[model samples]
Target: MSAQLPKIFITGATGLVGSALVTELLAKGHHLRALVRTSSAQLPGSVEQVVGELGQPVDLSDSQVVIHAAARVHVMQETTSDPLVEFRAVNVDATLALARQAIAAGVRRFVYISSIKVNGEGTEQGKPFKTNDVPAPADPYGISKMEAEQGLMALAKESDMEVVIIRPVLVYGPGVKANFRSMMNWLNKGIPLPLGRIDNKRSLVALDNLVDLIVTCAQHPAAANQTFLVSDGEDLSTTELLTRMSKALDRPARLLPVPAGLLELSGKLLGKDAVMQRLCGSLQVDISHTRDTLGWVPPVSVDSALRKTADHFLSTL
Candidate 1:
């Protein structure tokens, strides 16, 4: 007979990562509980819903593990008077509060889904971000994640509950939104974008690949109290990425050969220098440690993942 899977309590069950994780965990026969704001929130039939927000008291008494996937994600536009404070209210303070509750409830493991921004905004060419590097967060969102990581590490040292942190690069999949989806729309509409001739490598994790790693960290004995960086094990240039995306969407890519320098200048004048940097800059991550440490590998290939994403995008149209 097979052994029973550990009971898991999860946050952000309605978000991209959380929803996918919920499906994956349930498939593996793990009993699941989710924190939701409303009882009407849609989730899998097997998940037990607990209504509450972060920073509020929660009861994880029956759970053996906790996977914290919710966070105050990056804000492209600074709308708040104090963005850091707003981020900390949910990302750091609420995360720590949940950890304390998990500890008190005898939860054995806590898997945190962090971002690659905690490493830095960009990496030097050919010098990928590694697992052990001094964090240099450039924005308030990254800062809050780093602070939460630090707090969790301190808490782990004083408690029996193991803490596992996994920092993932840009995640794209069926339900992806924001810039990735916009790019797909531009390609599908045959928009002439001046993004060709740019040479920059970027690391991205597919939603499925990231979810696989998260589940691995949740149960792997070696994953206890360790931090990991994950990716699709393939790096692609901006031009290559666009080209692949075009192929996946079965659309023609009208990429003009615009120089990167000119694009940067235009972006600077328009107060979008940060946006241009992402297009023209490289941010690679070395996942050797993640591979060696836990014997983990991204189960999905980039092309396959992109094809899936494109299929979803087309289905929604």
Candidate 2:
């Protein structure tokens, strides 16, 4: 990177990944221009926030690189009555619109943060997902992401802007919500989870590790016109993960040797089979290409990351 850092524009500056990204970019001495909604709060001092919506025309005239990280994530269900129409508004239409504006503004690079769901819900037995695998998005969210990727690729071919797409699995760290919070809750309550007997491997990325990878992609020449699946480069089963969390929390992990089949059957009966599968099923990613290409490795180990997350949780309590 040059001493005079490039002017970078980021969307969804307040989001989970986006917020961390903003901090990382600032630390690297990059000038930041963040696109935010009217209702959004002020960002960090380093970022210049531009109030705008996805549907509105974006002004990227001064930006050297654009990172599209904004989306209507978890707003609507994929099985909704008209998911395509709903998702296309932000995920496809708005994203493509922004890309077009970026190109016209002479932005040299565009990095898109996508999801591993684009590869499908589950992985093959004992095999992690790779970048070369064919896309088989199972839900509307995944389908929309795939469409956005394709659109960006086509635009890249037509314009001078370089495009890089990243598909990251289960990212966790401080300020996390939903599943991460639930896991913490379980550990706090000392509940003996039924996952003790399961040994299904799942891939996860820590926020710091993921942010490092994203920043590296933004500047690395090798990242242009490439797609990568990112993780912590370590796979862990639910039981193992819980154990680590327990260790981090300095608490005994209360776990039962329950059978996976029984747990699945109970979850199905309770109308939570999908949730159960996600918790117990194996979903791994192969990041060898990322290492060999960009010469990037995860900065934080899983143990340290988990401990930090646990410490954060403990602090709040």
Candidate 2 regions exceeding 4 Å error are 1-3, 39-42, 75-80
Model 1 whole-model lDDT (C-alpha atoms):
0.94
User: What C-alpha lDDT do the candidate models reach, one value each?
Assistant: 0.94, 0.88
Give candidate 1 regions above 4 Å deviation.
Answer: 1-3
Question: Which pairs of residues collide in candidate 2?
Answer: none
Give the Cα RMSD of candidate 2: 1.6
Worst 10 residues of 2 by lDDT: 71-80
All candidates' TM-scores? 0.98, 0.96
lDDT per residue as tens, model 1, 207-279? 9999999999999999999999999999998999999999999998899999999999999999998899999
Please give, for residues 210-288, the per-residue lDDT of candidate 2 as tens digits.
Answer: 9999898898999999998899988998889999999998999998989888888989999998888887788999999
Candidate 1 colliding pairs, count = 0
Judging by lDDT against the true structure, name the best candidate.
1
Q: How close is candidate 2 to the true structure, as a TM-score?
A: 0.96
